[model samples]
Target chain A: MARWQPHASERLVAAALDLFEERGYENTTVIDIAERAGLTKSTFFRHFPDKREVLFGGDTLAGRLADGIADAPAAAGPLEAVAHALEALGRETFTAERREFSARRGAVIAANPELREREALKGLGLTAAMAEALERRGVPDPASRVAAQLGALVMTLAYERWSDPAGHDDFGEAVRQALAEVKAAG
Target chain B: MARWQPHASERLVAAALDLFEERGYENTTVIDIAERAGLTKSTFFRHFPDKREVLFGGDTLAGRLADGIADAPAAAGPLEAVAHALEALGRETFTAERREFSARRGAVIAANPELREREALKGLGLTAAMAEALERRGVPDPASRVAAQLGALVMTLAYERWSDPAGHDDFGEAVRQALAEVKAAG
Candidate 1:
């Protein structure tokens, strides 16, 4: 499985995370990550543009989630459609092993102000993309805005929970709980 | 009016915003702002820690907003309480003249990655403060999370609208629209 090209990216990420944990994000270079992954710098560069990108490999998750929302069954409402897409992505992106890595990556980003800003920009971009996707689906004014905003909020809360040790629940469960909380409060 | 200590801070902020717009945030120095405000450097320093702090003079808006949420009347639920608090802060902090300054400041922040990260950090801090306030008010698990997350989302959306030329609506109105949109989508 590790020999495959598709898995190569994952291997680079795993290696980068390990190196980042061992040495700080600033201290860990592309060569170090590549060496740890048993690959060369060229292979590492082939997968990611830079060391910072390894932590953000999940960038494509937003586009995929948008596609899911767009392709959702007609019966599903906008929020429901977006949630379904996010849940599917959550399952695939934040697996048990990946949760540990994800938590570590989040902590690293939080500690580094630059990384944290980049992460926020990425989140904002995803929200805009989701909004565009909803609009394309003919979801009108406030529906598109609401879906995008709510989706981003859910993601923020879910990520917060997923990153915290006290928050033992899975991302999907956390999102569900957050939504339920919103309804109950209302 | 400008002789008062409270008014001095406002004056310094006004001067800084003027200088920032005239010269740019990077090029505008503390001395330049102090001169523009017709105040000594000592007076300027007393009001703000530095030139950048002037642009972000309302950093305490978040804490004030949190306090508002904490102290809202029992009739309002958590979300309503949070929304009311935000509205109150908008009335006080986001004046008509401040809107134009805010739009320019947002552009400055957006163009610079470091400034953008600092903005994100401030936003995260505000959200955490809101969450803590809600928790203290006996808002349970998901309710507290959702209230805080929604508060942040509404704030972000409102700021986005207020910053855009086409988004002529007031901050409070923008927030209301964002909340309505969410409800409509849901």
Candidate 2:
């Protein structure tokens, strides 16, 4: 039996990040994270499958992107639909308040091979999710896939800038700038 | 002491693929692969770092793509350079003789999660390699990256067609067609 805890997931994530930075990802344990979060092991498991998953939001981000694309203007072109979804991400997931945490998370994942692999797989999933959303909107095969890939590139570039410590731009601005550069380059 | 073995790497890869298809990847061991190839475990280690790597060419494909891009004509644009590299892949790595083996390898990889993750990461590496090669050719930042991304998509589409058992087209034909479709989509 597990007791209800407020913000258990967020607490666990923050605790895991702290522990991972302090003692390294491999040196830390699930129990250590749970204890650090002031929650039991079961409560931690309820939110995440393993220690590695603490930093990843599972399918939440993918779902949000898909919904955003689905809800884009009916007449929007493929890339425009993708842009709408990315803008939605800025307002929702990549909010300004999450900038510092995202930068730290990126650094931690970059330092670990396993985390890097997970990140790579997660990225593919996000691209697939966006492509599927486009397809459901009647956007056709290669076009939908192409749009998703370009959209993903835009997101990556925007994320790099948004999460940079020296950069002061919001996620939306970063996304717009990246989208313009990608459009020009394409 | 390790003795020089003739075509040891190729033999090991073939044996590993056969064993993986017959008994599954997890059930097969490095020793089984070596023995099946009539080679010693030392020969296997000399070629690959682990069992998972037996299916992956370990940066060989990336190196080839980069080399091809670097060797492209000075008059070629970024996407044209990528097309040139992909055509080279058809003449070299994805030759007709290797089609059956590549198809089987892709099937084996698609059946397993671990292999899929490795494949995803390898894809990112290939994209990065092409981008760097383009940059060395004086192509700018976002342009190089965009071209690489589109090139990767073309390669993926070409691979799907080239590796299809029922498809009669050559790898070069597939590359040309995919490149055209990607251009249209873009």
Candidate 3:
């Protein structure tokens, strides 16, 4: 049996991902993951709602984007506010220390169609959160939604490029380039 | 006993959605759906690969958008091409006759989280097809993706409002309104 350790949640996530990679996602269960992490099944539940949530969980990123957008200047346009949010989140969320983790997570997600669908849903959830934040700022219906989606699209494009192991551009620069491309397309 | 139907495919989809609603998505099975549709299981298989596909399986909308973009004028820029595709598809795909079916489909999708995730994936798939079409016309990576996503977002927003029974805007009007919003935000 594995021993109890510090940062049990992190250890559980690392161990679960490792098991998912080694044994395939469908074959891995919460019980199996819990045993691998040397924790009780209840402990696993305390950390994440389910085995699937272990990988796709976390409202932190959404919260970060929402908070970032909410902090934008009062007079900024919807798209401009969204840009500020993306930049703020990109700088704070995609730090150098987390690149490897993000890359590995990306690989795990890319390898599974179910995971890809879940990931896409997560992206839309982020978009919805951003849209709601824009709406709270008094931005109107379709405009707020479209602007938020454009911002999310740029952020997603930047993430795919930035997560490549050979990628040279950091997350913030990649975001800027993507935003520029959006403007150029327009 | 239910009699065999001429429109087996449409019958299967209608049956599946009905069963999904009455019995809850998880409780409904292929056999139940097929029997309710007055078709053999094999007939149901011919129409849809599985029960889930009955709700989430059409690519007709994506194909329409892709073909629309491919046929856009050479002088049209990426964003302009995207707008053309959205208008073209909206005109052809979201016809008045399909409004009731579309509204029922939207309700079914909203009632289930798994279906909602699949819907998002379908939206992204449409975006990818649009992006590929843009690339065929020589638009670059992020620009093509951003423009395609913008068009899809507008289409999605338009579809949601247009599907509402109380909605007054025609499909084309909603599409035009959404596109205008995107332009304004840009």
Interface RMSD (Å) of model 1? 3.5
| Best-first order by lDDT | 2, 3, 1
The residue pairs that clash in candidate 3, if any, are none
After superposition of all CA atoms, the RMSD between model 2 and the true structure is 1.5
The residue pairs found clashing in candidate 2 are none
Candidate 2, B1-186: lDDT as tens digits: 559999999999999999999999999999999999999999999999999999996888999999999999999999999999999999999999999998999999999988988888899999999999999999999899999999999999999989989874599899999999999998
Model 3, A13-87: lDDT tens per residue? 988899988988889999999899888897888789887778765999899989988999999888888888888
Per-candidate total of colliding backbone pairs? 0, 0, 0
User: Candidate 2 vs candidate 3: which has greater DockQ?
Assistant: 2
Encode model 1's per-residue lDDT on A101-123: one tens digit a residue. Answer: 77888878887766876787788
Residue A151 displacement (Å), model 3 = 1.1
**Considering only N, C-alpha and C atoms within 3 Å, which residue pairs clash in candidate 1?**
none
lDDT of 1 by residue, B1-186 (tens): 344555777788778767766777778888888888888888887777776667666657778987889779988887788888877767777756678778878877776666666677677778878888888888886668667767777777777887687894477787787666555455
- Each candidate structure's TM-score, on Cα atoms with residue i matched to residue i, is 0.75, 0.96, 0.88
- Least accurate stretch of 10 residues (summed lDDT) in model 1 chain B? B177-186
Candidate 3, residue A162: Cα displacement in angstroms equals: 2.7
Model-by-model DockQ, in order: 0.32, 0.81, 0.69
Regions of model 3 farther than 4 Å from truth: A1-5, A21-32, B1-5, B17-29, B168-170
Error of model 1, residue B11, in angstroms: 4.8
Q: Tell the DockQ for candidate 2.
A: 0.81
